[model samples]
Target: MDPAVLREDMVDGLESDAKGVLHDETVAVAMRDVPRHEFLEDDRTAYADRELEVLGTRVLAPSTVARLLQPLDLEDGHDVLLVGAGVGYTAAVVAEIVGETNVHAVDISRPLVIEARQNLARAGYGGVLVDCRDGANGFPEYAPFDRILLEAAAVDPPRALLEQLTDSGRIVFPCGTQRQRLEAVSADSEREAFAAVSFDPLLVEGEQSGAVERNRMTREDREHATRRAESRRGWEQEWIEWEESVGPQ
Candidate 1:
């Protein structure tokens, strides 16, 4: 409820490190423009002060969402399809990042989608399209997006999702069943090839139960990483360094 703690916890926690800032300008504007607490449940309204609510099946942590967006390199002129709309909190933040006309969100829960649409409307965001549908599969009717982001963790990237990307499009999400991870996927339609970078999934205490333990990349995924690394013979040194920064396998 207190704006002071909200800024300190979510905003400050996210911005404390330079590496944490994804769309800095967008975050700044959203921080000032949107009323995030309004969308949370009655009891957890103030949790926005330092907490995130488990809205339906999706759990939205302010800091986690902010961290997720960091590597996206999103900007204007990009049409983004967001999976897991959540109570529209992530959508609102994204709506602030990418213009409304360029954003659409889909969720599996009907009630959540209704609430998402209304919440965005109440926030005066006209660009985001909230649909009640499966998030694992992107909105195909809109086909071919410049960018795709999944808010939920999956063991692997869904097949249908890749089919919807415009050439050279990029996707960022956490993947892996037991050993969940955050990965960046970039596709080259001409070659039908996609390269991804994955890190240990963010596993926190008191979160969802039944989640599996983190594992090294699958044998295939590992080989892909190795082959991709080898393909860049000249850049091996740098690529290796980058891989190290992502943390050990």
Candidate 2:
């Protein structure tokens, strides 16, 4: 039960014809190198192809992670941004492929961000950047990432994330709300769907864990009302009396 042997078996299973979730040699090697146990509390199940919940966020299973990353076509020295850095496992795997300094991750939950940072550092990827920011907003401070991977599901790729992609950059995300598909989109707006996937919806600022407002729709409604109030016109603000206007004139 050596961790290295476990890692090797994990990648091998993913590459096997029955699963075929992992085919890219680069990604396969990276998965083998990154110690998944460093990111999980139970070392016994570290290499298992199953999801686990960490800090109220669901950590993607190994096969799911492979499916998510295989579409990115990651390259050495590529600047990558990972949205929804749950347990930092995916970020660590990516760092192994693209160097530690090139990986940047953002999460809406502050506690998860802190945990991911600590886990990543312990995993020897201390150079990777883990920040607490709403995944939809993305990490704009480091704009123009060469590759962006959104671990959560959204009906459409967030506008901010798309705007932050380099001209040749590609973003891989689970696209949709009710039903999801693993898809990749280029900065030029071309898209390609890979497979059906189920993922938690992307969290907004007020919907994240430990936020005062846990209801995303309610916050959205409040913001919509604010926009409506700001856009109120002459007649839209209050009811106008046609009779009073004529009489006054």
Candidate number of the best lDDT: 2
Give the CA lDDT, 0 to 100, for residue 102 in model 2.
94
lDDT of 1 by residue, 1-249 (tens): 565455445565456565454346566556555667666655345344344445435446565666666656677778888887777877777777778878889876666777888888877885689986656567888978888887766665677888888787878777665555567777753222222333333222222232243223334566898898767764556645766667877
What's the C-alpha lDDT at position 85 in model 1? Answer: 75
Error of 1 at 205 (Å): 28
Residue lDDT tens for model 2, 1-249: 899988899899999999988889999989989999999977768889998888787888999998999999999999999998888989998999899999999988899999999999999999999998778888889988999999888888999999999999999999898888999999999999998999888778788877887767777898999999999977785776757766954
Which has the greatest TM-score?
2
Off by over 4 Å in 2: 215-218, 223-234, 238-249
Model 2: how far is 65 from its true place, Å? Answer: 0.4
Candidate 1 global CA lDDT score: 0.65
lDDT of each: 0.65, 0.90
